[model samples]
Target: MNAHDRHPMTVPSEKRTAISSLWLWLGGALLVLGIFFRVYNLDYKVFWIDEANTVLRSLGYVSQDVTDTLLTGELFQAEDLQAFQQPSPDRGWDDTMTALRSSAEHTPLYFLLSRLWVQTVGSSIATWRMPAVFFSLLLLPAVFWWGWELFGSKLSAGLATVLVALSPLHVLYAQEARPYSLLALMTALSSATLLWTLRSPTWNRWLLYGFTIVVGLYSQLLFTLVAIAHALYILASELTIYKRFTPNLLRYLIVSLGCIVAFSPWLVLLVNNLAEVQRKTASLGDDRYSIGGLIDRWFRVLNQMLIDRELAGWNFLLLLLAIAALVYLWRQAPRHATWMLLLVGGVPFLALALPDLVLGGERSLRVRYLFPTVLALQLTLGYWFAATIPTKRIPQSIVQTILILFIGLQILSNTVNAQRLVWWNKSRPASTYFEPVSALVNTLPNPLILTESKVSDLLALSYWLRPDITLQAIPDVVTLEIPQGYDPIYLHNGTPETEATLQQQGIRLTPIYPVNDSVDPWLWQLEFPL
Candidate 1:
């Protein structure tokens, strides 16, 4: 018999090669699916409050309807406001940067890119979401490489790519014209480099890491947590290896100093606007971050990862899996399982939770804040399924089954999120941004639309609606004078509060009546005797 036939090495080698090819093919297929989902229904959801901010900020157009704060006269030029009869033209680059620096949160990286993007693509709703879609698609391959570097398993890397591609929350952010996708991509890149750097701290890698941190901070302030997480991981690892201070220990210290020097501009800006940051945080979510609150939020994020729903009882299962994965990594690959595990999976979450718990901030409750850590957790799970259990000599089919279950859950979660966005009335998942008033705008003659919202909100709507009808948010109706030959209509935002507030202010109306109007942007319309 021939040597090849006697040993049967050729057939087994062929089988292994075939399996590897299949894994690669599967990964490619999943990447395509993820890109399709990103592009699908790009202009589906209406510009909610947050999305409206993105549009206005991108346009650099100050709305005539600036929110009337009680202290506006003291702190801002409410009277000197720049109101545009038409959607304001693009403010020059410098002005755009200046406006964003003062008015909107975060540094101007994403918004600046978005402005230039809209200038080229045209600022239609569908076109606006394209940048985020690109970022989301970009993340698939990025995550694959990052996971590969950490776990050293082609299967784990491919699976991590698949998981990120199908992640419902990531998909939702990907469809929006927001900075989270950009931030996610940056952090993922930083994470991949950080993992490589941990293995061997070289000068080129340190410079790249510092550069990424600068870009990430420019993208979003939350990225600082990622930097801190890396620092802690390096410290812990060095302590374990050397157990005392040495020249090698100074390597990370130098990286920190480099970041400090590079990020000085944003650091100064951050300090100057601390109060504004606090206000924005308070506006974002509940500010309680106690031990109990942290536990609740941890589970909430895990829930978002696993089920993408708000229902309870799934937290325990998630916690158990996390423990099992950690224990397995600790036992099987202590070198990799120590620093990478803590940096990627532990520190970012704790960074947010600890600060919020002590300082009582608003970010702890938000899922987006923990994005870096969330990805780490996902990566760890991928390693667990691909390496840990299989390393223990478990049946390959069981491991494959676990992988299938995870993918299935992710797909189902995407389906659930899709249905919610498509059908939810509050979200108004429609093509045109002005769908809320589409029927009313063309039908009503010379209609003066009144809202209790800020001028910015009305300006955003005006951006979508034609400049034929007038939109205003007058807080005080008593001083309001009705223009001659115009029908006055008040769109109620889910309550008779507008009418009640009018009565409370002793503003006698010319038969201010509420009609169940389905065509108007608001459900309740108060027709007044003007």
Candidate 2:
């Protein structure tokens, strides 16, 4: 009967429409920006030491392999490593797998995917790194989906997507020939999948949850830790009477069984190589970490994620402010606090911390291990931005604008450096760093390199400086001989033992041209007294 009753909420509804449209465009722009960032100079790096492993052992995509043979080193026959120590495209699939299991110590999913990809496209540096870029893109929508689930607001989810897109740490891994980006992506999906199972323990959801865990494990060994995080969430949810425990509990057990069955093949191999695996992983965390060291490591990784470099000057100040805001968020949104912490932060923290306290290696120093933790932080910040009631005094528009501006600043920090836009920090891409080496080689008239085959990645060397140089291996450093007529003799990451033996053999080498981040220092001409 009243005029006010006819379309009473029209104005407010229009305002909501406008805000939603603005955020949708803004988030879409950010996603586009991320894609552009990843594609910028995508092929700017040759395979470096770690990447060489991916090419040679993981995928067999390269023309040759530069990895070394296994320690029981003398099995140089049919099952001897085809790509081991010296990678030639001539090696077979079995040989590559044999070398991977015996030495590389990685799962075959990424590598197998890589194998199929390169077969179709023809392997090149760009082709090799394309998978990382693909996964990096997949993670974008995944970030938005998870963020939306956490905050139930497009603004929050969009903000988180922009941050994940512009993350320097993630960007670095995205441009490499490695599985870290996949690990980060899988971690998010697996976590979400498990949460979905708990929320609705249907047959389909349980199957998906189990399947995601299997893929996550195949992606990265560290992903198994996420299982612990899921269990913790389930226990906490049950303790708080959030979910009942009958069929869901049984489904959870079945899910666990499914994951174990799926991962059984890799488990068998892992058990066989348990000693080698232990020896290799033992170097990750050390028992000697002081409280100061732990804090420093945590802070440094945060800086790396946002800045694409270390914290300093105004950037450091911004990071501090961000930390304050995140702390505020933790207080305001405790709904998922326990789950987020246990899933993304606490389990990882304890896993690394316990190893450092009990084991003797420095495992937690590597920032890559904390990718999931950073994801959780980003989600928390997203939720804090989306809240309708907690900070009602502050206008939502201003809050959204401020958070968006802060994320923009982070993007600027990473993109300001042309190199960091593609990888990490001011450190040049592998291609850029090796450019000088190639330029140097071009100037040299017929170069011969004498290197210890195992230590030097000749595949990388050949990749950059090919055809003009001949690489010779020195089986015994004691019989060191730089043959006459090789003109300039370069030692590739020569060992102390080799240098001493050369001196004992009365061979003097001039350290004429030395390269940074190279397999070895070159010995050209001869050493001259200052």
Candidate 3:
């Protein structure tokens, strides 16, 4: 028989099915292991500053409908003030709420959904972090599906899923209250949809792409980087198919215009609040780094993002290898090269870093700026695992083994980091601090003169509690105004000028109730006769 007519010896159907099932089990096991590493004992750690803010705002949003309505009226102007409230308890319904409230700086969609979630699961660390965890979990399936469709190989799909599931960066955000994990999932979904749209190219598909892009962008501003990368890929893909660029250019413009129209509401707010936003950027305290500092900071951020911050040093050898792997892939194919340049490196690096220089070098640079770039790097690595498989020379098992080894190394490094860094900090989760502050509002009297430093905490608490108290931010030296019926109680932590000013205005300076220590004290419950 001719070569085309003859069929190679094949395993029985049941064996093939068993083999397929085994692979699925392996992928599921890897995913479970990844999630466990990220989520196990998650609440044992303390809340980072940003996490505290998110929890405080979230509580304010869900518990205080009116407060959320008011805050949304001005793009969350109460953000700083609201953060003054104490941390949430990380317990039941109230706890879930606080975590969500603290995280309200971004779009409302995720937090809004989180409100519903908290209503059900309650606000344990596991529950609060589950949304991001689940989203990261969704990414594994998405990577598998994308690989299968793009390369028509189940091996490639399974390998990619394993790589993504085992990635340290994916695990890091997966355990947080933030939206980066969701953003990564959305990117995968959008990419998958884009691939399907290319095959079919229907109007519905185009609209689906548009909607997905809008949702992704709304989820996080970093998604704009994802869109930029996709746009370049689409342009290049079209050039490949049509052997020309003009008609594709017009089509891209139409699709892009649609995205702009959909995203205009956010764009308008972003533009109008540019100045206020710049001030927020400055609060990060990273503007003065030299180019060397920037590079060092960039890699350090990447390290924290990929593995746990504690495990960062342990994985230095692997990080160097990962960098080399990226270089190798870029050299291998133009598609990989374009993606790394445009999507992974180009957009996030320029957008975050250039803003400091362009906005007059006033704002501080931050690690979060590299979020999109980090996602792109994860995707690049997945694609690289698919591309570098040696078909004839090396056994397929050997190829899979090598990719799995890389994942194993990353996980090992992260595990070591988690033991060292996360444990040592004994970080206080958002709930612990926020709930007490929220409680203090009920205990304290009206006409409360909250020091300016405490304004953010109080505003966050007031948004949730809405205790009929007169609120004023105590700047360096400011008079406290009391209404006719109520007496004014000055809340001071050794700011004599502030206290004297309040006293001159007929307010009493008394430290009746102090929870924490001197440097950063808690609410002062001074008596006020009605």
Candidate 4:
């Protein structure tokens, strides 16, 4: 054989294997760090307004009898009702539970699951919020899997996962009793699965993708933006990358069509209920923080969510690395990265931002909304870091040094944030009104009351105490005065000025309970003696 022909042109299997091992270790370390951060204080902030709503309704739904009674505004027993009518400054569980069961306004899916969870865990705030925590934890693995898929390197994927795990914005939502984190996990899985299904025509994968998309959509209406993004991404891919129409595209279309068909029922209900939902949503005032204000707030959000709070000074460092990664992959990744970025980030943001422009702002910059985009950005960045950087004209030592520095910064930032999470979770801030009202329910039977505050927590409390209550805004309850001969136990959460007005109407305002006395502004519960 000629000398030129005898020279080897392939990498040794051992070297390739070593490289694979290195990436695996990098990814694993990142995954562990991410999980630890997200899970540290998951139990803290257990019963925010939204969560209370979810928990209460879920509890009511778990027991068909309770759910029925709750829905009918007759969840309290006769004895509880009589006790609620007594002259005491306080009535127990009866009043609170009855009010909540009858008056809460939110969707039922998450709440129903919450009721089952509370039954299993005794309805403690920590226990009630555990489900959200668990689901939020799943996002790390999803991020890792997603990153690895796009970049074909565990190292790159792990880096993305680390970014997500340490984000302050993500932690904020993860700490709450909401479905945004679950929605994020579903989006990551659905998008990854859709990519795989497109490349390989497997019915099971296609089916799984469809299921994820449907569940995500049902979980939150905003997922319609995701569906729109995916549709656009597919169209772009077909026109640009694939070049010609293929059987796989048709299969994808059919599967997507099937998903749309499955989602029809919920879609119809959403359409029918649009007016009610819109009215409630529109009541929120037009309050814009200006373009500069929006940018500044979003910057802080991005910083906390994409980098560690403690190392925020080093955010610029991390940003440079991300920029380097993108620059490296620019030529090879223009199409795929652009499409993924547009789908995951560009579209939903525009959907959210556009309404703000026309109607001013209405509290729309939630971190979880950008979860899909952040992950995609990581994957695209990772691909750039791994594939393009190594092949560039830069020196080998310089490239190695840059990768090591970037990864090290990410690890340091994530570690600091994980520790922060532990501290935050253990520090549970006490609420003023809920505990007192909950205690009062123990004294009253059919304790029907209305509160100036939101209704979800009260409803959840009723579900826990098994009371027949109808809770609402005073105006709402007054508008529905039933001929059933019942007077409501009113609780005021407004300023002293409003309390004085209620007192003038012969309603007695009692001192706030000790549990939340320090925090309560309305230092009295309105007594309605039957």
Candidate 5:
């Protein structure tokens, strides 16, 4: 009579058990759905330029190799491009390492693992993306561990697992042959380990944390921001709690230094190749967006973390929810946990975002660069929901209903994205046009593709084109020949200079695929001199 009556908010033990079971089942189901989406249309999407490069490096070839072999104004069969995509006896692991080193901005770990992955499994497009799928699947558990450690609540961990599992952006990257998913996995694991180490500064735990740091850096350079966040959290926590440097803090610094020493080889490589790295990554710093545009895109990306339908007003609502969650955490949670969350969530974002805002760059606009921020935000939201839903003030049913609606929206977004051959996340212009253009080209009786565009573009398209088609690289469009016997010839990704040269030669190009001036056409049909 007394215990239950006095605590009206305290649900009966059996009711709590039932609610917990329900959440566990829902989390399990969402996890299965996430896995299904990651592997569903693995080969359906356009293997865009970046993915093509991933495959190339995995096969122990670089962009320079493609240029040297295929882009010397030579005529090659569409099938020939597959050579660079396929692993060979001649291009061994050493060659793969060499190829990866050429692209100094790209860390070698993912590519090296990809080389091994393809060697074991055949180099099909789906197979190439499987590593990312594996990492993303692992990410669910990693995120779960992180949330559990941060909030010390099973419900919070379960909610975090469910949220990340259904994240459309994560699902999209999981299907790509890229390291972003690996980076997420590393970030989550490292974060969880950091929290675990803080709870008990055991030697083994510290060693484990150091390992995550090294692997995290290898996973992606952006992880440097994560490590910095960890260091800041350690320093701040020690100062606040002990009011002096503690042995635990000293251990963390030593472990971090060890990780830095372990990572020095790559550091040396990056430093030595600074100019090449800068040149390779110069596009990231392009003055592409105004401050307002960047802020709008940031909201859009945050919204995409869970729901990507782009419904009007959704972004602003999400921003408010995120703010409320952080405020709630700061007020309700322990100071150390709140501070850790803030540092983990805020540091990486400010590091990237400030550069873009003040110096003018698009670094923050790239969703992959902001993955740590996304994961931290998801965790924050999870903790807030877990803490709030069980309270007597807000009816549990109402909170559950809101969460269900959010999940429903994510499911809807995933359904729409799964059916698409290209999406906004595939930022390259050619990715949007490749599928339709390839379809049009395949329909012709005999087709020839001529381009003066980069060899990388041709390689990207080769994945979509039929082996029967012929591709001719016209280094100088003035030397282009209207090869006989091909009923129709298409110009692919023709440069402005190429178009001007063709115009001077009196060749008329009719826009074919896009059929609109809204975007510069990628495919054009040429009317040769009679």
Candidate 6:
């Protein structure tokens, strides 16, 4: 072979420098784009049912308070429902604590922070969501720290930051008023601290890890899955290294026990109110999906971490890419690194997914529950990109192209989500119907909405409705009264019993909105016998 053919062409040092600088600039730009998306149009989407519940809880009002105030068979305006959502002089920090205790399904840390936040800033819709946005912003740095600690490479850290910054799922939760963004922040921070402690094993490092464990548990009940993953990682690591129990393992156990001791009060509360917690979350066990449906949802949620658009072919391609990334991580990364990521991601997912697959439930269908899995996947992809993109091989060009396309798709998906009033992640079953139904109701003159629906439904609908529109909420159809002088009286979320009661009164109900779907009909106009 000729000398030129034998020796492959190499890019000059200046060209390599330029490429690195370009990648750095791109990372910065993606970070800015993410920040902008997080805060942009914060109040644009439907302040969904769960968000309404969040506002009420933060304002120190429980379900009973809502029942007492709004569902008293009284004639009220739409603005009346908003009173519970606002901060008042009467409801203080103590009241918030009381409300949180009553509703033991949620942990108090996020609500307490939100109470302080809305009290400091005015309780506007955008302001209510600001804390989540702030936490999500912090998540970028936490993810960077995690990547740096795990791989000890700035390129990996930067790539991970870029991935998290452009993640559509993160952007969706960040703009929400709920605690999922805080959960994501805690997950990233805890993961990073665990890695740091593993490397150093100092007393302070162990204490820091313990602190994260406490904070994470307080953030959400699902964080227990994260703690389980961390414990498994430490146990597996020590067993692999030392072949038995050692000082490092013992220290980790002590720290873990300390974390549990610190969190015991809340744990006691949860155990005491276990029935209430179970009652509240019973909907999670509802067998809504078949095994095939669950698998479909699994893929969709997995794809949603990066892109939300339902290009079926593209989604499957991304799923394959994720599998390929995991395989690459297993082969190229250290065994411990692969094990840590797998346990962190796989354990939590399998915990939920296995139940759904074996017992037939939709517990694993929740997008918020998969936060750690999303982070692990992102880190894997980030590591793969960082390891490959700097090389001079043909695969380096392919990897670079894939990275650009992936980020570009994320931006496009996020842009689409930003413009709409609803997206896939806003998956509260009844909340999605609020926007369109409200639009229909708003067009009508002198509309009175009579709801026997849940108190949360009333509050959620109020946010979309005009203040002048009348809302009469009764406990049941037994006391249902047809108010005078309303052009058209509508029933929100009409039930069979409601229809039967109206029929007995010789009033036929006409389905207005959601004509195609009979299930959970949104609006029904009362047709009285003339």
Which regions of candidate 3 are displaced past 4 Å? 1-25, 55-105, 120-126, 149-151, 239-251, 284-286, 309-319, 331-345, 355-367, 386-405, 413-530
Candidate closest to the true structure, highest lDDT: 6
Candidate 2, poorest ten consecutive residues by summed lDDT? 1-10
Q: Show model 1 residue runs off by greater than 4 Å.
A: 1-18, 62-90, 198-201, 244-248, 284-298, 309-315, 355-362, 388-398, 419-443, 463-467, 492-498, 504-523, 527-530
- Residue 54 alpha-carbon offset, candidate 5, angstroms: 0.6
The 10-residue segment with the lowest total lDDT in model 5: 1-10
Per-residue CA lDDT of model 6 for 1-530, tens digit only, reads 00011111234677667866887898898899999999999989888888888989888898788788767888888888888888889988888888899888789899899888888878888998999999999999999998877776677778889989989999999999888998899999998888877776788999999999999999998899999998888888788677998888889989999999999999999999999889988888878677778878878787777677777756788888898888878876766667778998998899999988877778887878889999999999998877767675437768889988898889998898899887766664677788778888888889888887887778888898888888887576876666799978988877788788888999888887778674656788888899
lDDT of 5 at 358: 80
lDDT of 5 at 227: 90
Clashes (N, CA, C under 3 Å) per candidate: 4, 14, 45, 35, 0, 0
Writing each residue's lDDT as its tens digit, candidate 5 over 1-530 gives 00011111244577678868988897888889988888898888878888889988878888878878877776788888878888889998888888888887888889888888889978898998899999999999999998877766788888888889998989999999999999999999998898887777798999999999999998889889889988888887778667987898788888988999999998999999999899988877778678888988888878876578786766798888789888887777656667767887788889988888887888877777878888988888887788778777568897778788888988888999999888887765768877788888888878888877676777888888898788888876666666778768888888889888887888899998788888888889988888
At residue 395, candidate 3 shows an lDDT of 67
Instruction: Give the candidate order by descending TM-score.
Output: 5, 6, 2, 1, 4, 3
TM-score of candidate 4 relative to the true fold:
0.68
lDDT of 3 by residue, 288-338 (tens): 666665655556655655544444455565477567557754554344233
TM-score of 1: 0.81
Lowest summed lDDT across 10 adjacent residues in model 4 is found at 1-10
Model 2 spans > 4 angstroms off: 1-15, 59-92, 242-244, 285-289, 313-326, 357-360, 388-405, 416-433, 453-456, 513-530
